[model samples]
Target: MTDITASPAGYDIHNPSITEADNLLGQYIPIHYHFQMLEDQARMTGFKAALNYLLADGGKVLDMGAGTGVLSFLAAQKATKVYSVERQADLVECANALLTENGCGDKVELVQGDARQYLPPEPVDVVVCEMLHSALLREKQLEVIESFKQRYREKFGGTLPIFIPNASILAVEPVSADFCFQGYHAPIAFFEDPGSLSTRYLSMGETKPYAILEYQADNAIELSFDGLLSINENGCFNALRFITKNILAMNLEQGSTIDWMNMNLILPIKHPIDAKAGDQFQVRFKYDAGGEISSLINAIEVIKA
Candidate 1:
């Protein structure tokens, strides 16, 4: 139950102009992620989970950060219409094409603009933006969606459709040779400038209950990052934490704070004794706000090759 604010406090994206976020995240997003996001199924989960809350007649929804408009098409199934907004250039093309292929193009609209900058053509009952990342570090989840929510209210008086983020903590033994800095680095302990380090965030880990803070809003620039350490059976290290906060509807405005949540992997990394290959280990995980999570069992059982 560590306060993420104590881990690695960063910046509020809402306070900064769109141009600022463009400088900080624009390049990294497309280069490091957006393409994979279009092809990966993980991005679709939030949208699918969102379907459960969709109103049978909620008309004209907005899918902010609609990487491939998957959520938009999905929402179109339940609602009368949907607008999928994506900031990345090529992604808009992909989402547009996907909409057509899915046969929902008639009801789904695609826009290649920042969700924070654009408003729906008409007022929407639901504003779906799954810009969330592991432990709320890697994406502009809080800011963009909040901004859209504000716009939604200004244009029409209605609550935003920000569903629950519902997140928790998972502690596990590192999985691969890459996760083991001590054993992999072996005789040489110093790093050669974080090269080839896995940028992967948020993986299914052991289950345990933790009291981590949750945040959501209609508009604001809120973003942050944090890293924790862990060890494998042969002694390795890696980051271990993710976000799960519930986002209710909002009419919030500018100047909100994005508290960065961080979890430090203490057991395997800190223990004085080195774990040998094939050692049996258990990673305990916990979550808050009645959220459900499933993680890789081998994550807690780090076996040396």
Candidate 2:
């Protein structure tokens, strides 16, 4: 697997402050980091497939948070026109060069501005935004999209554009995590790369779906969830593993769906709780989308049952 932390500006997963800063100032993130995202084959393949499938009929498209303008380039292949909006001036310049090199300057228009404030002159057939993060936290995906949706509705009436990755499923599982590395111990929240062998899932309870976020529909800024998870094994429930599955695009005719890769988040509990087989745990958590993980940590309540 490629090293996600190879860039000079890359963040340490266990360092909350650094990670939070990166999330808040995502537009200013270094260009090398964007290159890493472009190099992700699974991410590129899934998004490319979805774009090809959706743009088959050829319609106007809006690419929000259009990093590197790659999605805009893809949409231009079939869409009549594409408005690619990116806040970072550097990325916009780079994307402009790439567009010229690819001869897509005629079909795609690159705009430098905040996605939340940008609105196309006319209604679009499709809206593509990929500002996703684990558990819908630490990223402005929900905030930016929600703002755009409201503005678009006010301007274009009830007709809404089709959103790519229309929905996301959020699930959690109780696990025992060993935060010890070479005799040093640090119980900090971290992201586990998919297919990584370092982190093991020592399950204490059955994984449960906490939320299903539909991007097209109105969603709450702050989310609160409380549920009981049945324990099926004996172990120390030291952490909660969060998984986000993005439904990029679905083809009903062929019963197929395209999805992008997201790292699994392992958040350590403030106080680890011991559990046994046939036990139950009442887990309650409240957080605002695009908020710091520390907020979630402060609001978490775990009760033994």
Candidate 3:
């Protein structure tokens, strides 16, 4: 049990109350609509799973990147003790508020520091985290969890809860040309061709928040994104027919609908083009190797010989 008044980092607290925490824990708490739309419904489900994977007596649980401590709250139901690791400062306060308001202040420990460095007093039986960002952006989920896993394996054995990554894949057509074209000419041309620099592009500073918002799953080993792309006469590309290879953590029967998140980008002088959001589109995933042509797809429909 932690002292509600312990002045380690000086509470750094806002208001240790439920109602306050609910309003404050905004950034990480995925909206109900978006959470339902996600491929991994496991956040809530996985919390329960962690208990099953850990000690039946609910020894101890660690929710790394446990923004707002929602998962920790879930684990607190089962765990005799729970430790939440949050990197964000404000979020740490919000989580504390929630825990205190809920009367779980004694059972939960909120640490405001990098999980990578903040070591637990002892090895925990279950380490739960959802650091994964869309297609490995804005997050180093794998690296973070892998570090925890290795540490646990070294101290204990292979008692890690997250055994697989299960990276998923999904394809969709652009609703608008927002993802494609930069400036008058496609600015990405710099990476592929010269002279196109004259076309130029918006600097990273002149961009908006980019994140993965869609979800898909994959059972196959390879996926290809070779379709009509949105490129201006100037030379930038968008609305990529997203195909992924060596994608991680997938388990399903062939021809299954995989969940994935679409990346969002912002740029300046974007081209005005036609790409209705609800355009007819298809996504496919496959397991292939050696750059072989044996595997290909027009959409969800696979090409068979």
Candidate 4:
């Protein structure tokens, strides 16, 4: 919980209680977000590759919740027109300055407002949003994109905008990390969990596709994993590592991996389970729809594969 009275950083971007008016004034703004985004080469390169293919013919683009206008600038290189929407005043100002510095101020239009309600002057052929987090948590990627997609359909009457990440899926794997609870740099008490420091440990197992979210799909999202994992080696499983596999663009048949596609969410299991090679276990993974930071894990039974 955050103290509402004190104005520390300015605004809580994640907290929904803050009104739109306050958000425009730069309350609780994350000062280092844009810096971090700029530093992420994998993230930037992935979008660049996607935009290079999508905007080859000089189409129009709408960058919802555009932070620092990086994606907008990338699209503006080839697109006929680009609209960058951002609600935070500080970010909007910073992005505007960056656009000018990059010599793209004339090409891209910066819009300062909530993207959900904001509409472009003309229909856009493509929409780009990079609000994704590990396991789709702490960000409104789905909600914002879904709203834009819905509003675009209603306004354009069946015309659809191309989503940057056409689809994304979540994967998980059981692992045995004995020293995961302790600090790798040094031993620290703050990093210790109640039952995480176990002496017994085992190697990790094969990963599985646990949950999936098709951003362009109209169907309700299903985020649950109930399946059996084959135990290749005898080891103690104590944690589940979640991975986000995103399809940044379609028709790219390259075998090379995207650097930004590697963000793993590691959650400790309630209890460590000992297992042997050739043994199969009924593993189940689920999390609160509202909060995906932590998840509930279950291993019903271990049987011979």
Candidate 5:
């Protein structure tokens, strides 16, 4: 894991005063975003698998940012009751129709309100939310989950509801990604079209895990890490690749992993480094922990070991 430190001032784009009311993505964007997310088969399948395992005993469940209520419908199979909350009214309407069509209206309750302020009649056994982005950047997943945890703790005493995707770990690695750009390398804007980012790597180095986030944890400003990378054989390293590992569920003897279709965030190093076999170098980086789409700003340093 990389050493974490306070981020420098002026990078506070992600509102620190985030609330449930903050989920105002308006009308059209919500539908489009929902469609894009649903298209990710791996992500949808992972959630389904986790929901089935967690709700096997027919407990009460809450799905935050429920989007089209797909997860809520899935949870309805095993959960005795399910509450699906979404900020957009239009989505709630669509979800309602789908619920009726799928014969799940009886098992699930649809709430058209912010998850932050919306409260269920009783405490739930599990809370599921999927508001995540690559590297945990520019998304309200952390804030939303934290708010729910605090609210649940305040109202129900020490007991905490089970959280789907108990935790996520962000990892970085040095890679030869010159094909991504012409002259100077830069961070790819996945917000536009993630398909633009390809997984072609000329050469890659060992991964260094950083920024391990427990959804219930407090907000953080920045993440910093110091490490040494050994050049096994001569190679050119030009970019830092970021990947997220999400622990969606637990208790299975075999454990579990989700192939969520998340595009890796590739940040091009200012200058490329060429090293010979057995050569080593010290790598240090600091990343802003902002929750906005443009929060991919950071500083990195590499020196001979």
Candidate 6:
């Protein structure tokens, strides 16, 4: 086993130069991004199935941050009425056209406004908001849900609507990965899609859950984790892998859960720790739920034991 006192200087594991955080903060996302999101079959399939199950009894639904109105349309299939709120003007226009083309304009109402501030004229039975990002970073999913909950309580004075993708579990694991591609070495934080062939997990440490997010309940914006990870393999611990499991819906009778695609985030560490099977490490990390990845990079700390 080897002990590491501190992370090496000059290595920015979070990659401050990356503009994804900035891009996500913009008022309106580009169309190309929406196209990519629409192409995600796993994400679409999970949400559609969840909504179909939830709205089968015929209820009203509020779709916040409804990009392209896909979820709204799905909800309109069984929902008596659907309110789709979107802040982006372009997407709103696109959604309006889509609503007309689909011939469900009477059932789905498209409203242009900020999802965090928008409210339905009457109470809704279900709420669908999909502003998800890896590790809940660079997106306002938590903020929007919290805001809606507070406003709903003040207005309706009762239980809030059922939220789609009601909970999320965040986990982390230490890993060894190759950061070089075709002789170019850029060891930066990146997202590995499910079934990706790039990164290799180190079997030395177990993947540990650090955070749990429940949408309907009040949650802390800032999250911190301090724990010891036992290393069981002799290998290079060069990066930390963050995984988010989105629980879209659960059926108590059947004991089944519908989940969206898992987001795998790989963030390289400044220094690689070479350790034996019996080594251990005290790992500490903290980040805001809707904050940029750069802030998370600055808050990570690990001490060898």
| TM-scores, all models, native as reference | 0.52, 0.88, 0.46, 0.77, 0.78, 0.88
Q: Rank the candidates by lDDT, best first.
A: 2, 6, 5, 4, 1, 3
CA lDDT, every prediction? 0.46, 0.80, 0.43, 0.67, 0.69, 0.79
- After TM-score superposition, what is the CA distance of residue 303 in candidate 5 from its true location, in Å? 3.8
Candidate 2: TM-score? 0.88
- Cα RMSD for candidates in order: 13.9, 5.1, 13.7, 7.2, 9.4, 10.6
Write the residue-wise lDDT of candidate 2 on 1-305 in tens digits.
22222333223343333434334424345566777889888888888888888775669999998777788888888898999898765567777777777878888988977787899999998899988878887768888888999999999998888899878888888888888889988888888875562445566778898888888999877877799988888888888888788898888998988987588888888898788888888999989887777777778888886
Please give the range of 10 consecutive residues that has the lowest summed lDDT in model 2.
1-10
User: Candidate 2 — which residues are off by over 4 angstroms?
Assistant: 1-28, 195-198
Please give the range of 10 consecutive residues that has the lowest summed lDDT in model 3.
Answer: 202-211
lDDT tens per residue, model 1, 1-305: 21212212122333222355453322234422544555544335544554644445656676777775767777888888887778755456556766787788889878777777898777666666566544333456555555655676788676654443322232232332233454553321111111123333222233333333333333223222222233324533332333243332222474332221222222222223344444444433322211112221122222222
Model 5 scores a C-alpha lDDT of 0.69
Off by over 4 Å in 1: 1-27, 30-46, 162-183, 186-305
The regions of model 5 sitting more than 4 angstroms off are 1-30, 180-199, 216-221, 255-261, 288-290
lDDT of 6 by residue, 1-305 (tens): 22222222212334343244323433235545776788888998999999987775679999998787888888988898999998755567677777767768799989978777889999999999898888888778888888899999999986888899889889888777777779988778877875563535444577899988889889888888899887777888878888888989989999999998566888887788887777888889998887888777778888996
Give one digit per residue, the lDDT tens place, for model 3 in 20-137. 3232222233323322433445344543453454444666777777666676776787778988888665567667876887777788998976666555676665565555433232
Q: Output the worst ten-in-a-row residue range by lDDT, candidate 1.
A: 187-196
Could you arrange the candidates by TM-score from highest to lowest?
6, 2, 5, 4, 1, 3
Estimate the overall C-alpha local distance difference test score of candidate 6: 0.79
Q: Record all residue pairs in model 2 with backbone atoms less than 3 Å apart, i.e. clashing.
A: none
Q: Model 5 — TM-score against the truth?
A: 0.78
For model 2 the local lDDT of residue 266 reads 85
Clashes of 3: 23
Candidate 4: what lDDT?
0.67
Query: What value of lDDT does candidate 1 attain over all alpha carbons?
Result: 0.46
